[model samples]
Target: MQSQWGIMHGTHTTPVGRVRDGALDLLKWLALLSMVLDHLRYVGLSLDGLYVPGRLAFPWFCLAIAANLHRTRNAVVTGHWRYLGWLLLFSVISEVPYRMFIDDADTLNVLPTLALGLLVARGWQQKALIDRGLALIALILGAVFSSQLMFGFFGVLLPLAMLLVFRRPWYFSVLPGWVCVAANQWQILLNSGSVVALTGLVACLIAPLAGLMLLQYAKNVSPPAMRRWAYALYPLHFLLLLLLRKALA
Candidate 1:
């Protein structure tokens, strides 16, 4: 099928050049902001009702990853490696603050999960046995460490599912949406009576379509700066939130 980036079948061309899409950067910033608001719930806003906004964070990040992958007309391998590296680096850096900010949190935060999802998507895209095997290992690790703060095993899987259905059709997000619901079942059910739950459900259902639409319709946005410090934002933000929460307490 044809997409804004041109034809969508087969492997992306090699040595892909930079594709500037500002909407993605904007979305990333929005997602990050939403995540901060959500984390604030733990700090002192449990009654303030910002959790729903926070719900947009993970899916948005996943969508950004998928959008980046889709836009790279070539250099799939380089893109995958670079993405994986960034995720890994941030995963390590973000762990301490993630644990400190979220009481009793055990997971390695979302970056690692995203890294795993990147592996899964890259493997699926490349059709390589080794990559597939690595993806399975990552999935297993995610499950074993499910107690950790980030989305756990299911969280890791959500992005892969998102990548799978990307650009296919609007209806494709349903399965992933169900998976997302299952991943956060109790919370979803508890929030069901309220608009938050409804919106969360709808977001999961439409995330892929929304992401695809953004990429296709909003490709004119500038790409985010891919710098080392950008990754640090994850941990730094957590620390800042932690300090603010402590002060408020």
Candidate 2:
């Protein structure tokens, strides 16, 4: 855990030679922006169009987690636990605001889904007994309570699948994209000819590939590194948005 704590700090303050990943920072910012815009739809305005961009939020976030995990391959054991702890803590803290702001939340907050995704991703990467055991536990829980999770079974699997093809060819992302669509419970619409179906498929496929492009080609463009403090924004944004709703009323 001391090692992870060092990582927690090293993320914000790195050595001179440790060049920060600008594109990764950009993707994190993008995820945060998409989340805010998506929630704006509920602010009682004609913001339905925000939904499409909002759909970009989760997949990018999942990729960011996977990418970070990959970069710190040495710290998977400690890092994942620390990561899971933060997500679980915020999952509890954010639920009230999430439920308050959304009003139609039928499931737990997104953190639990992300937490389980972390476990799944790690399990796939390592064959250790502890890793597989924990992954199996999360799998059963995620499965039995599918409807109660933010994205359900496939959602829990999306991060693991994305981790599998993280730096592979862009075309490979389509595999996890399918998993994403399934996670969203919109697989039935995949073969349909509707506008929403196309939008869903496009967002699923593009979100991850776009993040990969940022990672591979946007190296020179420096973006602010997203650190631990960013987690505060999740619940804080809910309160801010809630205040906006009050003002609007």
Candidate 3:
């Protein structure tokens, strides 16, 4: 199956001198913006309406992960380990800020979910038994701790779904799109039936496909790269928001 990005099946050739993808950076920035908007709802303001756009954040982030895995499909294992390591490190580092900011937080911060999702996506892309085993373990953990995961089990599945349709037709993204909705508690949104809740539901349903379109067609116009240091932003944002909330009070 050939794609516009030249994805060849059963090809083991590593890309040479791979340049950074600006579209990915753009996606990351947009995701970060959406996340900030979502978190802003907690800033002692009556901004509940922001929830609609906020629905886009997590799915876009999962798309970024899928893009990264697709790009590094043939890279060395050490590099993949490094990626997972940063996520794990920040998962621990970010917990305090996450708890401090979020009221009665029931779930771990989002990074652990992403880290597990990464393992699952890697399992799908790789032929290694260890990778597959790790992915299985991740799935089990996601299942066992669904209540303790920010987006729950479906969130852990979203990245793998994104990876499956990464370079495929745009319509294929609906799989992950629905997964995104499920992860965000679509049933509750549906039950609410308010305009904002409905809008948020729609946003969650389409976010993955929309993000995929951006990745496929958006120009790589030298957007800022989101690197390892970007991990700090997750925890830092929570702290900043806590300060903002306190100041507003």
* Maximum-TM-score candidate: 3
Candidate 3 overall lDDT versus native: 0.87
Give the range of the ten consecutive residues with the poorest summed lDDT in model 3: 1-10
Better of 1 and 3 by lDDT: 3
Provide the overall lDDT of each model, using Cα atoms, as 2-decimal numbers: 0.69, 0.79, 0.87
For model 2, residues 1-249, the per-residue Cα lDDT tens digits are 111111222343232324467877898899999999989988888887777788789998888888777666655267667888999899999999899998888999898999998898888777899989988988888899999999898889888877877545557777888787777657565666577667866787677667666666676777788877889999999999999988998
Q: What tens-digit string does per-residue lDDT give for candidate 3 at 21-126?
A: 8888899999999999999999999999999889989988898888888877777777788989999999999999999999889999999999999999999899
Candidate structures ordered by lDDT, highest first:
3, 2, 1
Candidate 3: stretches off by over 4 Å: 1-18
After aligning candidate 1 to the native by TM-score, how far in Å is the CA of 16 from where it should be?
A: 3.5
lDDT of 3 at 49: 92
Q: Write the per-residue lDDT of candidate 1 for residues 170-194, one digit (tens) a residue.
A: 5666766666655555464566678
